[model samples]
Target: MSESTPSFVSLLWGTLFLRPYVFIFLAAYLCLATRHLGLGPTLLYLLLGYGIAWTSEFCSIHTGIPYGLYMYIPATHSQELWVLGVPLMDSLSYVFLSYASYSLALFLLAPLPRSPVSGHPVNTGRYNLATLLLAVVLFVTLDIIIDPLALRGYRWFLGQIYGYPEAGIYFGIPLSNFVGWFVVGLVMVAVLQRLSHWSVPFPWLSWGQSRSTNDGYLGAGLYLGILLFNLILTFYIGETLLGLVGLFIYLPFTTLAILVRCHPGFKAN
Candidate 1:
């Protein structure tokens, strides 16, 4: 409305799209996800993920039922965009995190049967109970590293943007926060499954399909990419012990996901 007021496009770009790693992850997800779902569905995916993350944060901040009593602490001199006291970039990051986790679950649990109609080893059962459950677990495992490092944002460049009134058990993070992540992560994957029509079979890969199956290589890469970024930050902030813990927690699982994905004999279907 005002001449100096930034447009929505500029705000989104400046607040989220311009960030170095966030921008890279967002771009990597779009490129990787589109290979399977195409551009249209990918757009829907982004919308669904953003909606679930923002809504959950809004609810938890107000009610304290899920994520506990945490409040936004806007960093001094920071011009980042906030939606109802929640960082826009924070919500946007969930889109990639959820997608990568969901994809990894499918890679590990979902069987890719060679469709009778199409010879490609495609998956149409991503919404099955097994896949959903595994995705939820992976998402939480990620937060184990995320919450601690994020809490130290002030010591690094992320700044002090949020705080929990009550101290938590794990590095000052509440148990309810992880529980909330599981709930929110479930909703994110579940919504994408229903909207994307998970039962609809699509082109997967050839018998000699590249080792990098959508669920296997690219998905796992994104998951690791996010983890490594946080771990680097942890060390940068002088939390060597925390950084090692993060590496210990994430490296083995990431290695296994890639191994399971790349194995030609791994798919039951």
Candidate 2:
């Protein structure tokens, strides 16, 4: 098929499969989630993430409450899947992104030493309020990189899918957009955590027996993967300043995850 006259099958394939970045992340999400949470939980997480993401986009566009006033640009109108004016791939992206964030939290907030009396890991305080703050911070940190580059979607693998009703200072994205991502990210993590909590005998449910090199840490590593992916795109598109800005947030977290993974003392403590 010619570039200008691509077939409908081509568009469907492009949205779900041929888009290299999105497809790769989707595969990574499945693999990591199944490795960590088993098949049942992984499936559940996928559904929940998609539902929440689509709902939030629908609500935000209609009421301008969560994500501020914005509308999809539909630059690829007939070339991608859309439901209620939101791209299917866009909502689907949240499944992997937020799962990785929540996994990073699980790695960082893993409880202290295992109990001698019982093989079970000790329950720390209520999700450790400290962890909650850090998780949300990390989740929001992702959007700092995401929203700006997405506004420059014309330059990257991402087509121009959406835009703000009013652009703000951060590379033509509104501040409210980032706030919405943070809120939505927090909600995603919290729901997944609750689900993990309910799933009996899951590895993370142990709370204290954290593996530095296991699935939790793998999720953390994926954050760096995402950072690198965007940085490459930023460089390719000549968004040097934006690339540097992403570096500022991602590098420190990368260092921290490395330390947490390599240092024996950091395991289960």
Candidate 3:
């Protein structure tokens, strides 16, 4: 490894040590994804997610296509690994975030059973247009909570890593940023939906048999975990107004989810 670039071992250790919370969420994703989607598909999602997210960031910084115009500060370049000016962890985050959102969408929209003996609540294992659209919305909603707080990363442990050229209407983040998230989320979830169909040959690579019926809950929980994590940080950093805005935005969705989850009619037979 060069002086500026750290070895994989060092990068992994540094990420684990510095961003343990990220790893916590990531570990949950790994277990839940491996169990429900099988190891092969889970690994493919990570690889594809990282590629798309990194490219989006790179493009946004240069041509301002998908995520609006923003630039990384490169303040952590020496301390952490950066791929072409974007932090490796920054792009890597989208993998879990997208998966969490996609899984939650499945939990909400799929024919979920309150209880099942042999399969997940989202037992259909099929993707439709509604699920795809809902997954995209859910994925973008995550950024609604995440990006605002992240913009103020200097106030917390995240540090000042990136910023927009101009101040945005909602918490200093531009509207185009969200539009960009929507586009990326749509593409990523759509890719995942396509991948869900392929059959893996290696039995050892598939975890479908050992998965719990409650695995869908775990997947949705990951989404909530990430949302709660950022909201808590927003409050912890004294951004009470911003945090409240996030709660207000999500309150209706949360209530809707609860109502849908509890309604006897919504539960599958």
Q: Model 3 RMSD to the real structure?
A: 3.1
What is the per-residue lDDT of model 1 for residues 1-269, given as tens digits with 9 covering 90 to 100? Answer: 64575666676666763365777889888877766555556777798789889998888889996788798886521355678788888888899898888777776664556767656666655658888888888899889998888888879777677889978988889999999999888888887666545433444312122333343336767886887788888888899988888778767776766666688565543
Q: Is candidate 2 or candidate 3 better by lDDT?
A: 3
Candidate 3 lDDT (Cα, whole model)? 0.82
Superposed Cα deviation of residue 181, candidate 3 (Å): 0.5
What are the TM-scores, per candidate, against the unseen true structure? Answer: 0.81, 0.82, 0.89
Error of 3 at 189 (Å): 0.7
Candidate lDDT (C-alpha), each: 0.75, 0.75, 0.82
Name the candidate, 2 or 3, with the larger TM-score value.
3
Scored by TM-score, the top model is: 3
List of clashing residue pairs for candidate 3: none
